[model samples]
Target chain A: MTEEGKQAVAKARAILENYKGKKLRIMEVCGTHTHAIFKAGLRQLMPENVELISGPGCPVCVTPADFIDEAVWLATEKNAVITTFGDLVRVPGSEMSLAGARSEGADIVPVYTPIDAVEYAKTHPDREVVFLSVGFETTTPSACLAVQRAEKAGLKNFSILTANKTMDEAYRALKDSVDAYIYPGHVCAIVGTRLTEELTGEGISGVVAGFTPSELVTAAATLVELCSKSDEPFFRNCYPRVVTRDGSTAAKKLVEKYMEPADAVWRGLGIIPKSGMVLRDEYAAFDARKKFSVPSFKAKNPPGCRCGEILQGKCKPTDCPLFGKTCTPEHPVGACMVSQEGTCAAYYQYGGVV
Target chain B: MCVGLPAKVVSIKDGMALVDASGAKREVSAELLDELDPGDYVMVHAGIAIAKITDDDASEAASVMGEL
Candidate 1:
């Protein structure tokens, strides 16, 4: 570390350690930030008055049960191959998870990227390929690109089941819950500071934070300093190199041209209007919902799981009776335990920071 | 799936950039970024290069911390 970096850490530590203001509830909206904080043992440097809460930033954790059921339906009923990021395979749907469906003769392929799924569809013309697209702004552009790639290649076997969501409305829904937010850095890198600036006008204050230890400490300390100095809401971009004022214009244009905002279901927060993104009418042929005519099944959370409350900052992971007892990561009973970014999984893995 | 990996672009051809993240190399879509070069660093998400990034995140944070 540079001398200036050392001084910055010292200053940030002093600010957090000497905090004497009213109990401030600052929520880290990104699951990666929650894990990074625990990995860095950052909670040990803070005063008791400063509390860090986890919000619904993990895409896998916030994905509703019905969406998984829809994927399972495509895999079983339509006999289509379900291509997804590895985490979703274990997440329990209405009847069974994709893993469970796989055991019963359903083909489920886990790939690192949506383009790989498009490639699979290209090679296997006889099998229909449906990629389970679930993420915030950071991963949506890649899915859009995959759709365009499939179209360009004249691959008619490719389709996507989108659970893509926007973070702006979610921030608004969670605005009154905390004093301020620790915004996800990558999301801001794509969407820009304009969203945060708009939130500031509406009295929602926060700092866009990167995943590094130094960046996290600086952002947290900056939040404490700014919040302590004023009663008015403020916005700060700690991750400036990646997140600019306009963000990635090409990425934004790709999503806007291909997808539209629609009402979507969240596990904990329920349905927030226009929070979800679906393929535009022109691209509906690549949509899994239209291609397979997948029917919706009623979704239910496992009994005694407090993932809903934990996601909204109403409770901590330890508050759930099954957090570590029955809901170990090996035998996860809820989506929160199934995802590495999930609050319950982070708390369980790091033995609870607070 | 939301984590962004910082990698150096080893090569670029036909809207695809071959990136190296600590000796592990893969091809990521460069369609979203313009004016990207072979040596520029980028933030890769899933299979796409979202933004051109600084070579060092810590030093960048240090400079911003000076203002804080």
Candidate 2:
């Protein structure tokens, strides 16, 4: 093994050995960390008493299916071109996905950056270009900046269909039953560590960890140790190299300047108060909802898909009847299977579910 | 939570900086800082530079990990 790998294993073993025979529950809130834990074979190494549960870390899994239908509608428009990240293309809507619409005659293009969508709008001035803005705080800043750029460049045809959600509200909404939170490392880099102070007084342990196996195991071990000691909240920098107490001030400022806090509907979690963000009134012209005149549509999830339950940490992916038997990645029944960062996708990739 | 990385500013363009993070090159807005340059490491979140990371903090973190 590489030196880093060896050290990571040794550290995990030390943590396990220290917390042996202690009853503790640590929840890893990030889907990437969930994938890393399984991939690193950490579960086999840890004692049975140390339990690690999953949380709503997958942004794609939490995205409501109704939004998917909205994208499909835009794609099928006569002179509308829909652009989105690659992972969102295959997520199933109530009836079909953007991929399905593309199969039938829709102009849905996958672009790397939001700027690419802006360029596409410039090239096809006659066509209305809509970028599907999806993600948490990490990606929202750029998506907001894209809208600001469009406004500056005077691109009249460019607009974004935003379904952006924030993390602070999501964490606040989770029930008090959760013992401790294994925070997402990437999200911490944007919002900074100060935002987590709210959880400190609530007696919840918050440890920001990276996606690597070593980092996750270290975080899990730390959570177990912290929980065993007391109910007091502790913020440890497991991913100190990347995360900081202040977080990304520049990104936060840009997000604040371009976007405003608005209620956004999460697929499983429902409409969290001040959880979603929308373009400010100054940039209202770039807002897709205002620019288009689509009929009112209420999209629902596929019948018997328990993705909502799975997202809330109430059940595992394998607990669903459709898991592996009927709903594979090729034919995903819900957004969990469609997103690369979804927990179901992680479980499927890392041999958790056949 | 948010996901971001600390990257070095390699160049500047249109009030944005071309940053290098472990060989991955991305453009980040430098609207937050005034005295940034090629050798400075800044935390990047969602294509925006959010904070300036100092050499002391980086070394301290590396040392902690090394001890583990």
Listed for every candidate in order, the interface RMSD values in angstroms are 1.6, 4.9
Tell me the whole-model lDDT of each prediction, alpha carbons only: 0.89, 0.74
Residue A86's lDDT within candidate 1 is: 92
**For every model shown, what is its TM-score relative to the native structure?**
0.97, 0.88
- Where is model 1 chain A poorest over a 10-residue stretch in terms of lDDT? A345-354
> Of all true interface contacts, what fraction is found in model 2?
0.21
| Top model number, lDDT | 1
Model 1 has an lDDT value of 0.89
Q: Residue A44 CA error for candidate 1 (Å)?
A: 1.2
lDDT of 1 by residue, A1-354 (tens): 877777787788888889899889999988888888888888887779988998899999889889988998898889999999997998877788899999999999999999999999989999999999999999999899999999899888999999999888989998878999999999988888998988888999999988888888988999999999999999998888788888889999989989999998888778899999999989989999987788877887688988888888899889999989999888888777878879889889988444
lDDT of 2 by residue, B1-68 (tens): 24456688999877889999889998877765567888899877555675566643333334445544
For residues A135-223, write the lDDT of model 2, one tens digit per residue: 88777877877887888889999999888888777677774636677887777867878877667766666778775566666666666
- Which ten contiguous residues of candidate 1 chain B have the minimum total lDDT? B55-64
Candidate 1 is graded, for docking, as: medium
